[model samples]
Target: MSSSLSTVLLIARREYLERVRTKGFLIATLLIPAVMGALTWGSATLASRAKTTSHVAVVASDTVFAHDLKQQLGSSAQDAMQVDLVEPTTASRARLDEQLQDKHSTLAGYLWVTSPATAGALPHFTYKARSAGDISTKTALEDAISAVLLRERLSERGLSHAEIDQLTEKVTVDTSASGNTKAAFIAAYTMFFLMYMVIMLYAMNTARSIIEEKTSRVFEVMLATIKPEQMLAGKILGVGGVGLTQVGIWMGAAYAYSTFGIMASGGHVLIGLTQVLYFIAYFLFAFFLYSSIAAALGAMTNSEQELQQLNMFLVMPLAFCMVMVFAIIREPNSRLAEIVSLIPFCSPLLMNFRLSLTQVPAWQVGLSFVLMTLTIAVILWISARIYRVGILMYGKKPSLPEILRWLKYS
Candidate 1:
């Protein structure tokens, strides 16, 4: 027994160091933060660039209405959806055509609103464009025109500005059993993405490493010194440790950045440091549980083909739980969500997402932890049993029944 543990630990240390010291590991650790920063900066930069407006020639008898329409449709829209309403008379069109010819005309096209109408209503028009703008642009312009027309209509009637303001403002109702807070919302989302990402990273990595070892004949050499159970356990532990390291790096960077930035503008959500401990707890258990299954699948295949086919069972449950993440958060206490959460395979993800949005009963949380621990133990035994015999098995992969038989072979 002492020898067994020594072998497992030695194998684990070797595997961990081999992976951790790789060029890939260093590149990933650096690139992930850099890419995250780049994305955030890029999004902000794109958002900051003011949209240029297209100039439309407004040949209108109602000059006051045209001016109001132009004012309502601000110049900012031009950056994405440019619209310029110039008072281009027939004489001006001859010159405007030359400007249009350069193909660099800031003018997207002209909307000739000919007929007279009050503000806020759509005017009859002919618009010239190279191509149609996207729906969002169209929708924004529609909203502006609708707002202008609605106000004008309200004025034409006997309604005051205050009445229109009261009518136009949108209403939202907040309802929650717990206090509705940003922290609660953030907790739920954080739980979801963390589980999703960590599980997938370690699970797929385990499978890939197993396949790589099998293809390269490294497993045969490694198998001589270590038992299959030790090897399997060590591999899962090692890969999971690597994933945890990356996660730690990310969390540390985020916390450090947040600490400095809090002086600039404090964040709204507040999750305690203790919650991070729970995240780690759930993460470790989930990674080991899933990586064992992934490793078993990896042992069952000589190539990627059969490996992928078997992974669908694993992926499907995760995908389903993720799909209902919002539902889980909305009704964390619902009978169905609760039942789903108790399912060992789904609990880590489903419960975490719900935990954020709802205050789960302590009994339920304790019960879930107990139940999932047992389930993971059971799963590990099964996977280890399969690995013991299946690891050395070659040729065509066995059927599900055959695989079950291996576990039950005694």
Candidate 2:
């Protein structure tokens, strides 16, 4: 092997080992998944234990209307609600109000209905709950009362029970038939955000690593033996490998957990083999692309503060991509999604997100990869020129004009 290639590999190996052997690396690798699992379990547990059962009383002037409304609420309750009929009397209402104020009372609230005295006149409804924020319960009550009123009107018109039942039956759309299942959405959202987070984190770490080495003057000594381009190449490879390794470990654990029926039984989408492969491919493309920019930013800045100030430039594109994520996921084949997914800066995330929701055209996918590769090559070339000069500079950040001149230094 050529001495330059050997030097690059050696530096890469050194960079990889230095990070992987750190206590922080080990702790972070294990702790992130543990924290994520704890959060998932905690959220699921809280949702399962949330107070879904709503206890309420129905009061109306008409006894038959009251009974029908009670029956409607009961049929749609799904065992998560209780309904009771109360006479529409001043005394009864005062007693119900007392129940609502009682801290130990399970009564969520009461619904009061005033049936119109004349035909074609509108009925009035007043729902009083202890908490005004219980929108779900309020919406349920509204729907049930409307159905009851509709049924009563139909009955008055002499419609049979069967006809009323047929008319009022709810129709549900099958999202799975259109390939828009909840599981798929959850999977796409999870994977897209996961990629966003991991890429940003590792790319920033690369920048921070460069800043540390540059500050400590480690590069001045290494420069005697390794070229700037080789050093930059080595750092990207090493840090990226570390990121890939951690991701692989997490994916492996996820796959194993899915096999045990715990995650699978919950109806959560499992990361299939194809998804995993695509994830790795996109991660590499994304990490290298962002890390190249990060490396350039690190080399140009003299201090961590300077790097922080300039960091927004690197973050803005990713943030824009994140803003477009919902739109892309909702309509993967839309013209906007299609166009954005092909932009080199956005492709790594947008394209992968598109893949998760729907099958992207092979040409678009191929073109995206091609564009990203070319962009990476261009950025790496620019970063190498900057790194060659900026690695040894100190005490001040370079201006844009100075940076352009650095690029011209060959």
Candidate 3:
């Protein structure tokens, strides 16, 4: 191998090893999956416990109406509600309220129904609950009352029970035809954020690492043997490799969780070989692009504090992508989404998001990769010029004009 190629590889190996061996790396790799698992398990457990039957009372002046509403509520599987028929009287309401206030009482709440005083007028409903924000229970009550009212109206018109049942039957939509948009949404949302996080983190780490070495004058020694371009190449490779390794471990853990039914049960769209490959590809594109910029910044800045001030400019593009997330997910194939996904700065995240939710055209995908490659090449070239001159210079931070001149001098 050429000495330069060997030198770059050697530096890369050193960079990779130095980070991979750190306790922070190990903790970070393990902590994310552990936290995710805990959250998943906790959510499932809470949902299961929430299914405990809600005991409530339906109060109406008419005994038959109250009974019918209670019966309708009982038929709903999701609500898991047990209802009581209470006469609509001042004393009865007071008793129900007292029961709700009693900690040991099973009565969660009560629904009051008032029949209209005139013909063709709507009935009034007032729900009093221990928790005013129990929207699910309130929604279930509304549905049950609406169904019962419909039945009553149909009965008054002299329709038979069988005919009324046929007319009022509920219709369910089959989402299987659309490949479960919800699952696609979850997968897309999860993977997009994951890409954003790792790319931002590791890319910034590259800059910080460079600044640390530069500040300590380690570059002065390394420069004697290694070219700045080689050093920059090595740092990007090594830091990116560490990031990829951590991501690989995360993907593996996700696959295991999915496979064993610990998460993403019932054919969830979480993990696949195609998605993995896409993730790795986009990750590299984003990492190399941003890390190149970070290295340039690091070489120019003298202190971490200065890096922090300038870093917001770097973060703005990613932040913009994040702001567009809901819009892209809502319509992955929209003109806006398509246009933004093609921009090299936005492509890595938006493209992956689009891919997860829908089938992107192969040409668009190929074109994005091509554009990103060209952009990375240009950025690396520019950053190398800046880095070559900036790495050795230590003093006040350079102005934009000085930085521009560094490019010419290099």
Candidate 4:
């Protein structure tokens, strides 16, 4: 191997080892996944527990409707809602009001049902609750009331119980897809989000490392020993390696959990093997492209704060691509998706979205890869040119015109 290439590799190893050994890195590496798992489990547990029954009292001027409402509320049995009928007397009203106000009361709510003396009049129903904002309970009550009213109407029209039962019976349609729709969406969203996170994080790490070394005057000593190009190459390699390590950890954990039955059918929801391979390929190309840009921006700025101002330029494209993802999700095979997936800056992420939602022609995928690779190569050359000059000359950050001149002269 050439001495320059060997120097780059050695520096890369140093960078990787230095970062991997940090306490913050280790804690974050383990803690984030744990937190994510906890949140998922907690949410599911809460949803299941939320189905516990509520106690509600029913007051009615019409005893027949009151009895039917009680039966209707308990018909499902699954919800476990308890309903008791009370006459609409003053004592009953006062007692219920007191119970609602009492913090220790077990009553979830109360319903009031009344009918007019006029013939063929419909009953008026009102619900008052201790927790007035509980929309789910309110919705359930509304549906139950509707079902009871429908039954009464059907009976008045001379429909028999057997006919009414057949009419009201539920029928569910079970549809099958070639691939799981929900699984595809979840896998795509997770992978796309992870890709964005990895690229932005490591690329910024490259820029920050450059700024820190430049500020500390370590770049001077390093430059004397090795060329700027080698240093830049090493930084990208080392940080990119770290990102790959994090991804591998996550994927391995997922596989182990899936294998051991820790995850309940959720492992099957992830994208397939071909998409996984595409993800890795896109990640590498995307990382190199962004890191090179970040390196160049870092070279032009003396401090992290200045680098941030220039960082906005890099952020816009990624943000645009993220927004475009929603559109792509809505219409994965649309012309817009296809065009955006071919655009070099947006291809890495947008193409992944396309691949996840629907199958793309092999040629389009191949073309996207080609375009991204070429874009990375071109950007790497330009960034190296800027790094050769920008690191040595530092004062006020250069203006746009000055930066353009640096690109020309360098």
Q: On residues 284-403, what C-alpha lDDT tens digit does candidate 3 reach at each position?
A: 899999999999999889899999988976799899899888898788899999999999988989998888788899999999999999999999999999999998888999999999
Question: Against the hidden true structure, what lDDT does model 1 obtain?
Answer: 0.69
Regions of candidate 2 where Cα sits further than 4 Å from its true position = 2-6, 21-28, 31-52, 77-79, 178-180, 253-270
Candidate 4 per-residue lDDT over residues 1-410, each given as its tens digit: 59989999998998899888989778868876776566446754775576537789999987877888778777654355788889998899899999999999998889888776786787777889998787877877887788888998899999999999899987755423434455457657877887888788888989999898899989899999898889999988998888777766665554444345333343343445566667777888888889999999989999988988889868988999999998899999999999988998888889987887887988998998899888999999889988878898879887878777777873
Q: For residues 1-410, could you state the per-residue lDDT of candidate 1 as single tens digits?
A: 99899888887888899999999998877776566446445644664563534444444556766665666666323333434556747866666666656677655445556663665445675555434764444445556556767777887798998998788775666533344354356435755776787788779889888888888878799888877888988888788889888867755654443344321122432333444555666777778778888888888787888887888857887998878776676677998888887777887787666665656777777777888889778878888888777777888888889998898876
lDDT of each: 0.69, 0.83, 0.85, 0.81
Alpha carbon lDDT of residue 327, candidate 3?
A: 91
**Stretches of candidate 3 above 4 Å error?**
39-52, 259-268
Per-candidate clashes, comma-separated: 16, 0, 0, 0
TM-score of 3: 0.93
What's the lDDT for residue 105 in model 4?
A: 90
Q: Deviation in angstroms for 282 in model 4? A: 2.8
Clash pairs, candidate 2, are none
Model 4: colliding residue pairs: none
* TM-score order of candidates, top first: 3, 4, 2, 1
* Consecutive 10-residue window with the lowest summed lDDT within model 4: 261-270
Candidate number of the best TM-score: 3
Which of the numbered candidates is closest to the native, going by highest lDDT?
3
Worst 10 residues of 3 by lDDT: 261-270
| True-structure lDDT of candidate 4 | 0.81
